[model samples]
Target: MFFDILPRVGLKPKDYILKFILPASVISLLLLILGITYFSGYTRLVVLFLPLLLMGSAIGYPYIELDSQRQKINERLHIFITKFGVLSITDLDRKELMHLLATEKEELGQLATESHKIFVLIKRWNQSLAESCRFLANRSPSSQFGDFLDRMAYSIDSGQELKEFLHGEQDIVMEDYGEFYKRAIYTLDTFKEMYVSAVTSVSFFVTFAIIAPFLLPYDFVTMVTVALLGFVLIEVLLVYAIKSRLPYDRLWHTGEKPTKIDLKLKKWLIISVIGTVLFTLFLLWGKFIGEIPQIMKIPYQIIFALGMSPLAIGGYFAQREENLVIRKEFNFPDFLRSLGDSVSAKGGGMTDSLEYLSSNDFGPLTKDLEGLYKRVSIRVNSQKAWRYFGYDTCSYMIQLFSEMFERCTFLGGNAGVAAHMIGKNFRKIINLRKAKYQSVSQFSGIMYGLAGGMALTLYASAGVANMVNGLYTSLDIPDTMISIVNIITPEDFSLIAYLIYGVLVIYSIVSGYLIKLMDGGHYQVSLMHFVIMLWVASIVGYIAEVMTGSLLGTSLPI
Candidate 1:
């Protein structure tokens, strides 16, 4: 509808009008009506933020996409440069070169896709290489990529040696990428401090919100909803932080899939689902049945934690698998260099070289190498065997380099030089990932500390409120002696405790996943952290409740 009306509107900033203004105006109108009639309290508060959230999302979407693509291209820039340089040194004709670019699996996805488009334009439309590159440069999603393409177009137009240009440009690009990486790391450090400060402030706000009702008498439901909105906002910010820093690499697998470990993990995944469902049903039954008040007394957050436990356990195994792949990558470059040397020593025969290298320890990758060698020894097709090895490792780095090695050797190129290139490139990526993880490590600790503090504050607030209210009851004070205030009654205390638990659970889940995201893009890696944080929050909240209750002569209902 907005697209149709956009021309009639004649908005000066058309992008804003088409994307943000129209959609936000519509949502705001709908939300206002709903807030005025059906929604009350916390729901109304959440409704009020919907239009702002929509506007922000519309404005930020393109920037986020561009930033994400930039990081991805940066991650694979070295690989692209190395592969293109190696291929350039080959004697392949232009057609074959274009074919190679279209088919190459090791190159960055954005670069490969754009190269394929340029290749199509040149082949189908008979456009010159320079023209095709210029077309792509203008349309490139990432600014860095556009700059590279522009440089390539200029070089081609000037009739420069493409190989020499690429070789020189590679260093310059790498230097730029290195600086970008350092800046991203710095941004993450800033995010960490901001996370700590925001969380501390949020905790204080929630505490004050919970306790202030005794004096101010705000709607209880609105307070809870406001707290949830705050949490959602924090989560959104964390997601942005993670996306900004995450490397844009696609995970791929080749050949027949599902190793023994894969099968085992699948079963565990099912078990996790079943366990979560059964526990959740049990909790729901207890809550509704009224027969088991004790079950209801068990904090809902604790129930949620219990229900998610199986998934967390399963996630530990998944995380272990991911880590194993990473560890293999750490040793992969050395293995490639060794294989290259051995192959060169054996007159470029890969079979004997693999046999020779299988005896050598290549760390976590040794087992896979041994398997590859054995398969080849048994007269298995070499490509098939290598693909199997790559798939079995379940590492994106392994898959990429394996394909690169296959391409180099298939073209009768110098395998030793190829090995050296792959090794250095892979090492660079590994080091960057390590640095990224290290940057967030301290912030992760701070998150835990904040969770603990939040729990303590909630506990103290509830306890103190109960203690004061109890004295009011014990004194048998006249109605005239007390001002009109919202008393923290038993029911109110129960509800407030539940709200605190809900917020704490949210905080734990968000912080845990954000930390994992900053460390790596793997969702599985975040599970153990989520489980740990949940436990910390629950334990701390429970402990504080018990201690404060004992001191204040008032016990939590649970």
Candidate 2:
């Protein structure tokens, strides 16, 4: 299987062996020699693993590359097909359609690359379209795309109309895409379970580490650090896994011009930065410089929460913009359908059609639609006008499909048919995103609950350990008993408390990022989840410490 994938990925077997495999083998041998000669004990053992890991990665590089190519191709294959179908209904001939699809590299990525290869075969090699399609199908990495090419090859050979073939393939292709989407969601669910189990186990281990130091001769700081690193590694791996498994979809448009929401986000971000700095300075002063009044004396957990509160402003705006984008995307298909019908009815003037449609309510999309009409009415460059419209709406799907609609209608395609096709696929994609959003919502709730639970357990353990230490210190015990008891000092408990706080902060950041990855939102939006998780951990941790102190009649000095 590895060898077969080489040619498909444009790698020759001889070149692979000489250029990659042989060099990696030599490097591994050198590393093994150095490890045995220079390293000792466990250090040598750790070094020895590097050679094995490197060789294994080198050997598997081809398979990894093949899988990556397949993912890139399959990522946008459904959209590529939908756009291709829309173009097929236009007056474009086979060659022109292939050329146009090949040029859409920005939108279609590897699918467009494959289309360009097919175009090269047809144009340069003078092969028939069916022959080229069949040739590419045989070597395509993605089974779904390959099957599509194979069927398209047969249809072209049998004198079927391209538009008719695509119309028939839509349901079949969409079903496959839906299945692919669901499988990804299931993968995320599995990873979510793994994350919860792994992180919970790590938290318990860290708690054990904190408590065990009081009973055993262990370095409290070193044990906690090791456990924290393990926790971090687990979260990082889960994040990467989730990111790879999720489908590629962007919530925001990537136009060159910044939209009004973008400007608002920028302004709020600056304000957030200034607020963070001022709040942090105030906390520092209260901690080290100023006298704390009775009312101002609060737990450090609450102080940390207060320091991060300013970031909520930026997060709020970002989330609001994302919501607006979703609403615009939802309303876009209806607006497109109406505009298409109007264009056909009025004999094909887009500006007039848009003008008529702009007066109708399209939820968040109405203002953007009106702007598009105004631009077009003033004889703005049609492409630029539509592009600006996409930027204003801030919806990736709307931008892509709107471009398709405009291009097809300009080329004399049936606007109604084109709009219907684009809208159908657009709606399907929206439904998939909604399903993903629901899953992420459930995952977010689980993460928040886990954060609170973890904070309670971790801080309660620390509090109990502190109380035990205090008890040992207060009681008049003999030197022999003192030597046997091995009670941790107040200073040690203080350090452990800070370590627990560190763990909570790290957990909050990682869990927030995981949620953002699943939902395909901006990273700034993760700040919202981050702040909430932090607050949850803080409140739970404070309650646990207070409860433990009241029950045990001792507490760590803050």
Candidate 3:
């Protein structure tokens, strides 16, 4: 029954139940009790107006969180695919990875609990794909890792062939995975840096979003619409500016890390700060440097605020610098090339040579790697340990290296050559990335522009709506203009009035998906699109108030 009303009402039955029906019903009952009071009616004030506003906000917050995560993921996917060459490892692979991950959960759990293998497997299986391995590896090989590899090894051609192939493919697989890892790392670098920038952007709104709205108690729809629109537009341009300021992608597999990020962050910070100071000084300098406003300067103030806001956010990110979480992930390919050499050397156990990397000099990943190394050194096995390392490290570099180490230890023949080949593959992957970035950067501006600019339009239109209210008074229009203004509207100033809402609605929906479709995936953007549209509607409505007064020539009433 509710489904039938969904399209016409622009809401689902369930939503309408919460948004329109439930509260409206409650308010309707209250209104029936209160009756229309003299002077400002309490029904409109306490019953109708406030409840709808609160309902809208409650429904909207979840949508925001959902969209925020969706946006983050889509963006991550875009950078990941573009910066690294295409690589597919789906949640579908979870089953396969899980089987390997739980190779010996029972044995490990027995030291802790005897009757829990199935439960442990299920628990580990449900964890994030990367996390599943982290959980297992942090626990160490015990017997689980070798058991998983033994399972992986068995899957090769046939059981005997699987064993033989595992021995042979160890170096080759490690090298290939290493190459894949490099491309992954290159992409992650940009993502991590941008993520920090994005977080800072979120922070700028953090204070405003929580407190200012409540204290001001101004027309919410008007301000929120403007804020959202401006946010979108500024973000679009700023993202463009940030993208522009970012150096071109360069393939660097074995050389020192990209120094440009450090240099450019500093450079842009200095430039933005200097520009802000000069502009502030110029404004405060008054007629000394420019035209002194003897008239309305509010518009100029608005423009200045809009223009300066993004830079403050940009400057925030330029200050935080995080080195690679997994530097060895990059170095692993090169190390694998050496491993192939070590394997061919015909000397001691392949296990001993591989454990050398888990050292202190590197960052967080090195510690994890050292733990994996420690497992093999102490227990003479690393299957579960390797899997742990593979999944836990978020960086593609670490996962690949962990996988490679497992393979080489099993297939000791080309450990050294495998290492060399892995490095070479990283070089190839890096080259491909350079090509991808150049092609992709072409649209970076367009996406950001569309996103940011459209958002700003949402903001500006509300103010325009507000401005419209005075037109009637200016024109000396009659009180009957609401009925007589058929040329401009059917119900009210309805023509261009609802036009902005339509635009903001479509813009929110399309942008949410466009961000996902063009780049990649988002968890659930639909809900967010709805929230954004609702917020925008409120903004445009506020503008409508001003516009209403202007159009009708209504004087400001006490």
Candidate 4:
């Protein structure tokens, strides 16, 4: 398996052995010897595993790289194939189409690299397209991509029209891609269940640790620290698991040129940072100084909420832009179809077609469409103008399909057909995104509910324990019974409170990022959820403390 993957990853067996395996083996041997000579007991055991782990990683590196490449290709295969079909409808022949695709490194990613390799084989080696496709098919890391290549080779040899073959392949590939996408979502759902179960278990453990001091001789802080560490590890694993399974559906275009929205987002981000720093400083000063106002001496929960409040401004703006992008994406298919029809009707005059469509309303996309028309009409760089339009909309899909539309029309392809095909596939992806969004929305609600429940349970347990300790302190019990009870003290409760707060912070941060992973949104957009979840947990904790204190007929220190 290792040798097979090495070739797929472009490494010869001898070279891989000489460059990686030999060096790794020597290092592993030396490490194992050193560990045995220098370490003792459990430390020796841990060090002993280090060499084995290192050797395992060295041996598996090629397979890992191969899988990474396979995933990258498979993730973007659907979109690449769709774009390929659109471009195949144009006047560019097979080689030209391949070269053009090879140039689109940003949009196609690894697929572009593969396309460039194929182009090199055909251009440099004078191989026929069919032979080149077949040659590459054997070595391709992705089974799906390899299968497509195999089929393309047969179609080429059979003298089928490239456009028609791609049109058929598009449907087949998309259907497969849909199944692949659904499988990813199913994995996400399974991970969500796993996450809930794991977190609940950790919460129970934490509660047990908080109350354990009354009976067990274990160090309370140490026990809680272990639980918190375990909780963090679980969250990290879940984040990684979900991220690995998520589809490569990006919302924002990754262009070098900054859009107006990008600039505004940056401005708001700066404001948020400045405000957070200032607010945090003020809170820290109030905390350290004895002259803090009585009203400002609220619980840490409120303090955290206020400190994070400034971030919401930037988050809200980013979220609004994200929504605006979705809205524009929804209207993009119609815009493309209309533009295609116009271009065809006007005999391939892109500027004239844009002028005609500029008068039409495309919902949130109308203004950007007008801007595109104006730029192209004035003979400004059409590519830059369309790029700006895409950036203005902040939709990655629009950038891709619009670029395809512009390129195909410029090549004198059947504009109406290209538009229809692009629009149809674009709508399919949008529908899939809708399904994903619905799933994430439900998951969001669950996360919020979980956060509240966790906070309440944790704080309520702390409150009840503290109240019990207080009650025991106020009792006039005999010395013998008092010694046997091993009651928790005020200082212990304070430590537990701090530990619980730490847990809440960790949970809030992890859960917020988890939501972002499921939805495939920008991390900055996740700040809103983080702030909201943090506030929910904090407020719930505060309420739990107050309610528990009242129910226990005690005035707990606020």
As for lDDT, the candidate ahead, 1 or 3, is 1
For all predictions, the C-alpha RMSD in Å is: 5.6, 1.8, 16.1, 2.7
List TM-scores for all candidates, in order.
0.80, 0.96, 0.35, 0.92
Better of 2 and 4 by lDDT: 2
Q: Give one digit per residue, the lDDT tens place, for model 4 in 392-500.
A: 7888889888888777766767889999988988898899888889988888888888899999988987887777778778888897776567566566667778778
lDDT of 3 by residue, 110-197 (tens): 2122112323554655543333333443332223332333444345324343224434444444344344335444554465355335
> lDDT of all predictions, in order shown?
0.73, 0.86, 0.41, 0.84
Best by lDDT: 2
* Model 1 stretches astray by more than 4 angstroms: 1-72, 103-107, 134-143, 150-161, 167-169, 249-256, 270-312, 377-381, 475-483
Instruction: Give me the runs in candidate 2 sitting further than 4 Å from their true place.
Output: 294-296, 471-485
The true-versus-predicted C-alpha distance at residue 499 of model 1, in Å, is 2.2
Task: Pick the TM-score winner.
Answer: 2
For candidate 3, which ten residues in a row score worst on lDDT? 81-90
- Winner on lDDT (3 vs 4): 4
TM-score attained by model 1: 0.80
| Two-way TM-score contest, 2 vs 4, winner | 2
State the lDDT at 125 in candidate 3.
Answer: 53
- Candidate 3 global CA lDDT score: 0.41
lDDT of 3 at 44: 49
lDDT of 1 by residue, 377-402 (tens): 88747677777888778776687677
